[model samples]
Target chain A: MTEVTQPALTIDALGKKCPIPIIMLAEQINHVPLNAVVSVLADDPAAYTDVPAWCRLKSHRHVGSYELPGGGWAIHVRRNY
Target chain B: MAYFDAASTEPLHPQAREALLAAIDVGWADPARLYNQARRAHLLLEQARTEVAEALGARPDEISFTSSGTQAVHLGVLGTLHGRRRAGRHLVTSAVEHSSVLHAAGVHERDGGTAETVGVSLTGRVDLDAFAAAVAGHDTALACLQTANHEVGTLQPVTEAAEICRRHGVPLLVDAAQTAGRMPIPPGWSVLTASAHKWGGPAGVGVLAVRKGTRFRSFLPEDERERRRVPGFENVPGIVAAAAALRAMTAEAAQECSRLSALVDRIRETVPKIVPDVEVIGEPVDRAPHIVTFSCLYVDGEALLTELDKAGFAVSSGSSCTASTLRPSHVLEAMGVLTHGNVRVSLPRGASAAEVDRFLAVLPGLVRRIRQDAGVE
Candidate 1:
């Protein structure tokens, strides 16, 4: 598979937990251009599940999560509206 | 960390620690044995019983040690129910009784008995008239009411409720897990239950006080220990520690109560002023001095707790929508309060006014940030 690299807005939610990471995504997703990806970096364990669930509930595009070089995750979401 | 979850558990009191260490050496032998070492253990055990009963305003013979407060509630509720089974199998309790009593009622219903729950008011107080009506029925084998709510700290009208139960010829079991060591339980209660850890005693020791002639027999099969009220070998060291802690706490109760009450008042007054859309639950005047609970309308309890934890405050919540459980707090629900984003701050005996003020300083900005991130208006 081709290495898929996309330009994305980044949010540093590291050390923040669920509802927080999701809350950050909800607030900033609209600032990104339509169909552009927003990346949330978070360490709270609950964010792994809550971020994806939030995306599904809000009808946003879940661009998938990737492990950061350091500990924690980079969960990617795309603004659908 | 400012440990504001004392209702859950307090740090062991200093005297409890010393007594526990001393008792471990002397109380290791079985008090039920007939040897010389056993005689010493028996003496220590009897002394512990006397200490606990005196603190609780109970007789030494009436106080029996159980493994935990939940066990005491189980034995108190089920034993009384079984002892009065010939009269009726009906059990009555406030809807907000601890899960232990509620679970006991569940067991009663499972065994071909009936159970009824009385509701609470908006302030988390039991509706006394409704409680009286519930126990007024002819078949009410037992009625359970907490001295103060564990989550909200609302003091129930136990004395009045006890009188009603008396008129109805029903035994009243007061679950004083939240208040027993820190305050005196109102009189006229037939049976009482209290936990050790909540009042700075060691864990795994609970007191079950059955007033003489209350007509309670063990629900479980006969056993030699605790006069068959509680089965299994006694926790002699834990009992000694618990009794010592109770005595020490009672000695300082009046002073500590006023001090903690002032601290709680500070939090109560500050939280609403700092945070928007917050509802502070529980009766302001009639509640326990150590506990103050409030709810934020648009905040998530687990997230708030996480933020507070990061800010070095350990607290608890009654909101059902926390990360571990999706159900809202029954106490909050019964009281008709906002059930989401609830936080309960219960000051331990040594919690300082400075620490509480620091929490108050940090809470508002954090709530604002979370709400701003969530786009909550």
Candidate 2:
């Protein structure tokens, strides 16, 4: 069995719309140390694809996404630089 | 206001208006009846059918008028599937097809038929190799592809796709709603669908053409009208006007195509430079001549459209904020492009260079203001 490492930070953007979640992610991703993972909790449907696409465009790594028990998704991203 | 939403619905052409008025006076009588008025109406309907067929490169008997483009798509997709039920219950379509085709595919799936959507490239072009692979099996009954993307204006390889479908003995349905009047329909499609309003004709008029020998059985309740493909009393005047508009637009397509291409090229090249963090989406070249889309970073799509409306420029967007479903555009999502703060500018026929320049001059300031308001600057 593989061990799951916890995220260094979690952004609770559950009620926010698109581009807001993306903006919040972009503003806060740099606060963590290099190679640290950040999880963004978003309910917007656009966030599902935009988060992964944003990672590609910014040269960051989108580790994975997980569905939350309450709702929405936890999109995990690793800061590469 | 300078209208930049032509891809949604073009303003009716002068020729269409003239034909509509003239035909409305004489086309009110039922064409199926046996009377002088009926004879006149029948003649007008046949003449319109011939005109539309000539413009679309099909025989008159092959063309049928439907209520709307969406309806045409449903009939084309479901009808072909029903006709080829013995062959298989499998369907193939591109990932970025219009909602009409996608919805039809959804219906197919709900009815126990299976569908496979081939992925597209970053430029919004369908992956031909993947498309070929999807239709290789004998179980694949039909494939649907658009002549050009409505949102991004990227052209699909319909000729090549049609060839692949032929090799597999599956019929191909080409949705030419965006290209019917602007460009010549490429050969090799077994069935074709288009909307009238996209080409300067009135709304509520749609064109569906099924090539000879293509197996198609209407899924709707059978009626003897429109070659038994479409039911109910036809919108005769609308069909006449649509045909007139198609002919006029086709005659001027070459000149207008070049003129609009230059304007769109200017927009594609200028948007990224003028606006900070702007991504101009879609193919840089080999696209429809009139459409150019771009996404502005850290801006709300609705706010930007409202601001542009105040600035006397009408535009459309694929952003999630603008959509009623609150979902981002499937086209953009499939292409993995930016989906927020998006703007799609499609120029209509006779749009002058001065109007384009004025639009270009004012766009940067609006984007900057939206970004500032969002606290992104």
Candidate 3:
């Protein structure tokens, strides 16, 4: 996989389950500058399906998910609004 | 593995299974037909009706079978509302009624009728004062309440609410889907509904009982079956199985209730003590014997259920956020309790004490692991 630009903000959602990870991303999305990428690290299986769905529902951009070296996933979303 | 979702549906009782198999050959013919075979089928159907009616303390003439408990509730709510339309169009029900009753009330509203939803308390019991006030309105045509709350297992004040409705001349429809066959239904309800599957009977059989004097107009397209209340050919075999199961369960209810109540008490006492940040929902003293519900902070109910299932325990979660439905449980929300990460453990008939102990022993660690996986501090 190719390396992407470092996110403007990193959310440590690892071990966090759904809605929590989604809620964290939502609450902190605006903390970063608009259009900046925010990375959420989470392992909860629900996060895989829910994060992207949340992005679509909230009209944010789900950049994509990447793997963390230690395991789990790094879900990327861009603050659009 | 412990099968602890009886509130959802019980495994078929042995009596039900035997009755179902035996009746299949005898009940296959149309009961409406006049041949000798049909005569036997008709007899079977009548016998099943009598069994169910006797179990429910209602006349066989008043009980009609529907496809499922949800169907029975729809028929009960809509039939009563339509029957009393001339009196007024207002319907009264609880905020935590099963989706069936709520959906029928929604239809009533869409059809230009009005409905008042009474709220429940933190313990998930209906507020009698609010209910009485709601039913007291002269324009209220019907009031619906459940014998027990399905999600949290808290018994409702059905008899008291029924008295208020009676005083107001409003018919009270009781959804006894969770309590029927497990206990004697309290008296005074004008109409009652229950699902066969909830009590170890076969699926596809639901009972709707309308007291003889209650005003209830059939809303289905004109039909001769089930007094035109529920239209379509009767499910004779399933009905036979359901009635047989009802008889068996009712016969053993006193003993089963005691056994299950003790198990539930153990769980009620143990879960909070062993698992931190867990809130046990439901009225401890006034709840159903076979069911208990609790919610965990900082954990996902769906994930927890998955872990439990993997560990060989089949249970259910009340959290709406757990699955496809993103909306939280209206029952929990109505009670003003935490809706996140809710687990409802309902013991089936014959659930063993050892199984309950095994589940209790494994639950705390599983919940802790799930919380850790969620990264909740």
Each model's DockQ score: 0.04, 0.72, 0.05
Could you give the fnat of all candidates in order?
A: 0.03, 0.69, 0.03
**Which candidate order results from sorting by lDDT in descending order?**
2, 3, 1
What is the C-alpha local distance difference test score of each model? 0.86, 0.93, 0.88
TM-score, per-candidate, Cα-based? 0.83, 0.97, 0.84
lDDT of 1 by residue, B1-377 (tens): 78889999989999999999999998999999999999989999999999898899899999999999999999999998888989889999998999999999999999999999999987889889888888988788899999999999999999999889888888999999999777887998899999999988999999899999998889898998887799999999999999899999999999999899999888888888988767788889899989999977558887899999999999999755573654456676676565657899999998998898899899998998878767765
Candidate 1 at B255: error in angstroms?
0.3
Q: Which residue ranges in model 1 land beyond 4 Å of their true spot? A: A1-81
Model 3 per-residue lDDT tens digits across residues B117-228: 9988888898899999888887989999998889999999888888888888888999999999998998998999999999999999999999999888987788899988
iRMS of each prediction in angstroms? 8.3, 1.1, 8.2
Ranking by TM-score: 2, 3, 1
- Please, what are the lDDT tens digits per residue for candidate 1 over residues A1-81? 222337368999997644566667777888889988898898765566456646654678777888888988888887888
**Model 3 lDDT per residue over A17-61, tens place:** 555976687668889998889999987655664566566546788
Here, model 1's chain A TM-score works out at: 0.89
* Interface DockQ of candidate 3: 0.05
